[model samples]
Target: MEPRQTKLIIFTAKLIAFLCFAYLTLAFFPQYAHHLLLVIALALVVIGAGSLLKYKSQRNWIESEAKLLSSEEQEEEIAVSQYSKLKYYYPVIEYAYSANGISYTGHTLSHEKENLWVPEVNHWGDPTPATDRWWLWFEPGDHIPVYINPQDHSEAVLVKDMTKARRSHHLALLTGGILIGLIWLTLVVLNYTLPLR
Candidate 1:
């Protein structure tokens, strides 16, 4: 199957599974459903804030050039649940760079954790050789622009996480809206479930 089709299938399966789980949870635990929604809202807010902070930190990294030593495509199997697993492909890049006369070997394409596995956060697409062939853009010994941590020369990335930079703010706002909506729903549920004085 085509990479895009496969990604769509996987995403659909995940969405269906999540919806089923949410339905079952709310059905079986009506009293605790609000608590579950609150937890999910808080988790989204925390994740969005964390991604924003990482993006801000990456903005301060100094730009440098690194010699590509080697690059390889690797696959990782992520288990979404006990019954299901999804396979994701990513590039393992090895490069050498020097900062402040100290040489370092780095092995990260981008600093964002999601960048390593998910190509797009909004769509939750799978990283495949056909979809994310970033390694194919360079050959051995090629000099590539990299961002290096000034204080820690060992920390480096071949690309600035533009996804994080572009999406973090939107994610924060989205999560905030979800949180407020969930809070309002929780209040309504409580009011309906509680006895009037």
Candidate 2:
């Protein structure tokens, strides 16, 4: 099995174990369930807000010109089961920039996670041909816009805020917080307004 498959299996197992434990706890200690959910909702809200704030701060980073050093595609195949497998393709970009009279090299394509897989071939109704990979967009020695951290010259990225990936990530975090908050509020209102059995 692929390492990715192992990691996914471990994560799924951990999540399932956690959910089972939570269910068992709530089943035995029903009185504390409300408080547990409220705490979880508040923690999610805080985490979501902090993530958005961190992303927002990246927008203030200064832009600098960078020379493309290399661009290539990384391919990985993960076996889903005995007769099924999934292939993922992502771009690997390397660029160099100068800041504060110092030169630095960066390999990040965006403020988001390092490994971002593009849509699979013919997936999601994508019209782009499989032959056209993201790495084909640039070549060595080409000039590209790079955002540099003013406080830390070593940190930089080729893409930043408002990209589809970034937007979706933030939106998901925000939605999680909102949905949990609503559930918490509704439960609180019901606990107070509705007659207890």
**Which predicted model would earn the best TM-score?**
2
- Per-model clash counts, in order, read 0, 0
lDDT of 1: 0.71
Candidate 2: tens digits of C-alpha lDDT, residues 1-197:
96557988998997788688679868987665665565566666776677677668889899989999998887777675899666767777899999989999998776444225654544454555665565677889999999998889999977666556556666677778778778767877787532234
lDDT of 1 by residue, 6-81 (tens): 9879989977887787798779866656555555666566767776677678888999889999987766666778
Which residue pairs does candidate 1 place in steric collision? none
lDDT (C-alpha) at residue 144 in model 1: 87
Q: Estimate every model's Cα lDDT from 0 to 1.
A: 0.71, 0.73
Q: At residue 46, what lDDT does model 2 achieve?
A: 79
Candidate 1 residues lying further than 4 Å off, grouped into runs, are 1-33, 75-89, 113-132, 164-177, 180-197
Compute each candidate's TM-score over C-alphas.
0.58, 0.68
Clash count, candidate 2: 0
Lowest-lDDT window of 10 residues in candidate 1?
119-128
